[model samples]
Target: MKALTTYIISQTKLPEVSVKNTIELLNEDCTIPFISRYRKERTGNLDEVQIGDIVKFKEQFEALEKRKIAILKALEEQGVLTPELKQKIEATLDLTTLEDLYLPYKKSRKTKAETARQHGLEPLAKIIMSQNANDVESIAFKYVKGEIASVEDALEGARHIISEWINERTDIRNNIRQQLERFAMISTKVVKTKADDENAQKFRDYFDWEESLSRIPSHRLLAILRAESEGFIKTKIQIDDDKALDKIESRIIRSNNECSEQIQIAIQDAYKRLLLPSLSNEALQIAKTKADESAISVFAKNLKQLLLGSPLGEKRILAIDPGFRSGCKLVCLDAQGGLLYNETIYPHPPQNDSMGAIKKISSLTEAYKIEAIAIGNGTASRETEAIIRKIHFKNEIQVFVVSEAGASIYSASKIARDEFPNYDVTVRGSVSIGRRLQDPLAELVKIDAKSIGVGQYQHDVDQTKLKKELDVVVESCVNAVGVNINTASASLLSYVSGIGPKLAENMVSYRDENGAFTSRNDIKKVPRLGGKAFEQGAAFLRIKEAKNPLDDSAVHPERYDLVKQMAKDLGKSVQDLIGNAETLKKIDLKKYCTESVGLPTLQDIIKELEKPGLDIREQAKVFTFNQNIKKINDLHEGQLLPGIVNNITNFGCFVDVGIKESGLIHVSNLSDGFVKDVNEHVSLHQQIIVKVLEVDVPRKRIQLKLHT
Candidate 1:
């Protein structure tokens, strides 16, 4: 345990006490958001990222220890556990080194070496290995028995045993691994059968490509590997064969005699049959794991930005899922996102009933008091927008084109089915588009993160790892903005600090049976919700119109008495202290600091009082695309257009320029100077102007340069 603590501290470069405290908190089953937000004093105010690192490293070290125990037990059962071997295994932290040490003792199927030993050639093999045998042929002749027909046969058997011995040597394996890591090249070739397939055209760039394994970017690696998985290309890791052989020969050969000649044969066999294949696979696996981590990190970052994008607040929205031949599915949602009405309008092709659609829209807008219109950016979306614009509404209504990337997926999900048992998929989808404009975080939590489509190669990365990383991001975002206790659905509440799916269901069920929660303390009455759950989750759950205004803010329930005392000290009520910026500015944070609540927590409390239950997210604004250029063919070179950054990767960002196909803004064109990271230049959903550099009509590719 001490060694594990030391290792985590060294890897994270964090204070030892803080690491230890975080480990203790995690061991006590506290979630990362809980520890980061509430347990600031114990963790030295380490944020969620730092705490997440601690958790990851601790899990890795624990897994390594488990492997060590299994290896030790195996060696003991095999009756080969010497004190020296056991000590080496116990003291080493590197998994590769430990595996190398245990290779000789590991059980395997019968091999050439075992066959030679079974035929009574062990003595002859040892004599040759000593490198002191003169007249090795005569020495080998003496060991001729069953399976050993002549002097040549005996010598061949001896060589085979020596080859296996060299392969198992710890020094030899380690040296070969290092060489492969430093000089290996990854190369890919298109499979002949798949060369002409249309599906394989996307990987043409990698069909005849070679790059240094250590220097290839994460995206390229994932792309090539994905192509290989789909049978479009074959990949191989290559190193200089001569250099590798020379290094191994130098380590094994110590003399220049007949015995040395035999050893050289063994070395060649070892290099070809054992070391190269094993280490090349190891190197590729290492590279693949690294690529997976990088891709998952990128996905998590993009997902965080997209989930926390600006919200339209609680507005009465009229959402439309537009289609050409099928007309448009429209639904009206109240301020809290409850579906008040739904119907279809044929403002587009086939049934172009423009007058009827306009009358229906205007009457519905006035009947439900619609404040905004959210139109899905799909087929006939532009025509639908034009129809809505043509209508003269009684009042000003803002119209927004919302991305409908995963609305269909959400509508077909079981959660959606349960939410709207009587509504069809179209109605549910329109409702999703409306609610997304209202609050992206709340609505997005109900769908799978992968369905949101902000990721790169999301389906190809490690699924378990990607899911874990994305779940953490969602949790962080949810807790960052906080959830309304009375209005939050089971899906949104499930992401709060310590509450999970079961508890979330329980809370909703409890709410349905009783009325709305009037205070944060009332949440404890839910079945199976204990003291610890309340302590971890109470701060992130907001209750509007509560008796104590602190219940609606981020201030934890544990600090309520302290806040009351502060208000009493100021000779004012709690309500008077809250939202009174002048009074809050005069309070000395140092005077309120305690052993558990430091200056950081005190400052946070003061900020919370200044604006209780404040949202950090910006309000959503209306964006206009180039009305004249609605399709790809309409674009020309050097034409400046308005676009929104839809996705970001290591290479560049893809911007939606109000067309079916998005344009690529390469990293080189992101800025006037060197741009190391594309994210530093633009974020997901950021509106910017770009100039069309070139357009490949045949390939449907658009090259764009960002304008400052």
Candidate 2:
């Protein structure tokens, strides 16, 4: 544990006390969100990202320790566990060095070296390697007895043994790795047989491409690997061969003799046949892991932003899944997102029933008392929005066009089926659209993070690593915003600090059987919810109708007595002290400090008391698309239009300009000068105006520049 603390501190460049305390909390099975929010003083007020870095390094330290144990046990079994070697292994923190020390002991199939050793050629190998024996032919002829038929055969056998020795030398191996790191080029060439195939056009840009392995971007690397996987291109990694061999020979060949010549042959053979293949693979794997981490980091950031998007709180909605020939599917939802009525309406071409659709929609709005209308931004979304705006409602109603990227996946999911067992997929999809407007975080948690469609090369990256990162992002976002116990679905509840899928399911089932919880204490009655679970999750779960107002706030139940004492000292009731800033200011936070609680925690409590359970996100607003542009063909050079920033990448952002194909706003056009990050100028779902630079109608691509 102490060693882990030291390693984490070095890796994160964090305070030693903070790293030590965080590791202890993690050792106690406390989660990232819990430690970040509840134990602010213990963790020195570290945010989720900093605590996350500690967790990452802690896991790495454990993995390294596990590998060390396995290596030690292997050495013990092989009877090569020297005290000096054990000390060396124990002192090293690097995995590469540790593995290099263990390389010679690795058991392998019968290679040429082992075959030559079995034929009694080791003495001949040593004699030639000594470089003192100038008569190498006589030295080789002395060993031409058992499998050696001639001096030439003896020389080849000795060279094979020398090659293995060269391969195992640590200095030579390290030198090759250094060269590969600095000078290797990753190149790809198109497979001549598949060049003209129609399916190969997607990877045409990668054909005959070459770039430095150390300098290529993560997305480009993933794309090239994908093209290679699809059999459209062949990839290679190489450096200057002459430089590498000269470096190796300078280290091995000391004297200019026939023995030096033999060592030269062995060095060349070791480099090409053994070192290059093995080390090149190791270098590529390192590069791939780096690329995966980069890609996964981008994906995690995008997922966090998308999940925390603005919400239109608790409005009765009428939502439509728009279409042309299939007839739009419409559903009415109450304030709590429960479906009240569902039907089909066609207001576009092939049906051309705008008047009839308007009459039905107006009557439904009056019948259901709908306050807002949510239209899915799918096929015919703009046309449907126009038709709905043409109708005048008796009451004021706002219209919203929500992105329906993963609605179909959610509609066909098992969770959807469980939620709406009596309804078909289209009705379920429409309800999802309505619910998304009410709360994007809640609706998005039900779908897989990867399917939410805000990542770069999500599928091409490591699936296990990507899923783990996205889950952490989701959990962090969920706990950061908090959840309404009565209103939150099982999926949302599952992301709360200690409440996993099973406990969330149990809580929901208990809610269905009983009634709404009235206090924080009532949560303990749920099955499988014990002390630790409550401690980790209770503050993040709100009860709006509880008798104690603090239950509705983020103030934990354990601090209720302290807070009551604070109010008592101020000669006021707890309810009166809540949100009373002047009264809250009168109390000295130092008076409440104890061994377990410090000023950081007290400051957090004071902040929570000031604005209890206040949402950290903004409210969703209505947006309108350009009336003149319907598709790519309608767009031309220098035309200004309104668009929404849909997806962000390292290079630029994609803007939806009321068309099927979104336009690309390259990073160069995002600012007047240098643009370090695309998110600094644009965010996910940001409404902005752009000027069209060019349009390729046949290819369905639009290039735009930021209007600002």
Candidate 3:
């Protein structure tokens, strides 16, 4: 256990006390958000990302230790547990090196060497490897008995054993591993049958592609692997043959005698038949894992940004799921995103009922007291926006074109069906678009993160890892922006600290059975929400206008007494101290520090008191697209247009310029100089003006550059 703590400390370079305390908290079943947010003193004030690193390295260390124990047991059972070997195995830090150490002892598939050994040819193999005999055939002739009918058979069998010996040499295997890691090239060629297949066109870029395995971009590698998996291409990893062989020959051969020649032959056989294939595949897998991590990191970052997108804050919205022939599905949502009215409007070419649509929209807006209009950025979206803007509304309403990426998926989901039992999929989808404009985090949590459509190669990467990573991002985002307990949906509450789907369901059921929770203490009366859950989650759930003012703040219930004491010392009531910035700044944080509470915790309490339940997110703003450009044909080179960045990838960002096809601003065109990160220039849902660099109508692809 101490070793595990030390290993994590070394890996993360975090403070020794911090890592140890975090591990202790994790073992006590505390969550990352809880430890980082509430237990600041115990964790030395480490943030969520830093504590996440500690957890990651701790798990890795525990896994490696488990494997070490198993290997030691195996060695003891095999009666080969020498003190030196035992010490080496115990000290091994990585799985690959430990496996290499255990390779010779591990039971392997039946091979040429095992057959040679069974035939009593081991002595001959040893004699040939000695490199002392000038005429090895005479020495080999002596073993030509008992299933070895001739000298040639004996020599061949001896060479097979020597090959196995070379294969088992740890040093030689490690050397080959190094060579493969440093110099291997991954090459792919299209399968002849798939060369002309229609489905193969998407992967044409990867066909006949070759690049350094170490330098290939994560997206490109994932694409190549996906193409190979779909049987469109064949891939191989290789290094310089002569360079690798020369190193192996130099390591194994000392003299040019018959015995040396036999040793050389064995070396060749060992390398070509064993080391190259095994190590090359290992290198490929290592590269693939790295690529998966890079891709997943990109995905997780984008998801964080998308979930933290600016919210329009409690507003009645008129939303439209835009279409042409099918007509626009319209839904009016109240401030809390409850659907109040639904209708269909035909304002496009197929049914030009512009006047009727305008009158209906105006009437609905007025009836619902709508504060904003959200139009889905889909087919006929620009035309719908134009029509809406032209409406002579009686109120000042902001119009926004929301990204419709996963709206359909959310609409057809079981959660949606449950939420609106009497509504159709069209109504549900329009509601999603509207609710997203209201609160993206709450609405996005209802859909699977992968389906949100922000990641490249999201589907092709490791599904389990991607899901785990995205879930963490969602949980982090959810806790960062505390939930409104009175109005939060079960989907939104599930991500709160220590409140999973089951408990979230229970809380919602309790809330529904009763009227509403008035205080943090009231949550304790709910079924199955025990002391631990409340401790971990109470600070993140806000009840507006609660009798106890502290219930609406992020200050934990356990700290309520401590804060009350502070207020009493200052001769003021708890409510008086809340949001009293003048008084909060005057209190000395160090005077409140105790054994359990430190300066960090006191400081956080002061911040929370400064503005109780203040939202950390920015407010959403309305964006306007170029009304002249409704399709790709309207785009021209060097045309300046306003656009919103809908998707960000490692390579660049994709901007929705109010067209059917999104435009790509490759990383090179992001700035006049070098561009290290795409987010530095643009973010999801950010409105920016861009200059069109090129447009290919044949391919329906438009290239863009950032407009200063």
Residue-level lDDT tens digits of model 1 in 27-51: 8889999999888899999999999
List clashing residue pairs in candidate 3.
none
Comparing 2 and 3 on TM-score, the stronger one: 2
Task: Look at candidate 1 and tell me the lDDT of residue 479.
Answer: 97
TM-score per prediction, in order, is 0.97, 0.97, 0.96
lDDT for every model? 0.92, 0.91, 0.91
Ranking by lDDT: 1, 2, 3
Q: What is the C-alpha lDDT profile of model 2 across 567-665, one tens digit per residue?
A: 999999999888999989999999999988899888888999999999988899989998878778899999999999999888788999888899999
- Of 1 and 3, which scores higher on lDDT? 1
Candidate 1 regions off by >4 Å?
150-153
- Model 3 Cα lDDT, one tens digit per residue, 383-500: 8998998998899999988989899999999999999999999999999999999999999999999999998999888899899889999999999999989899999999999889
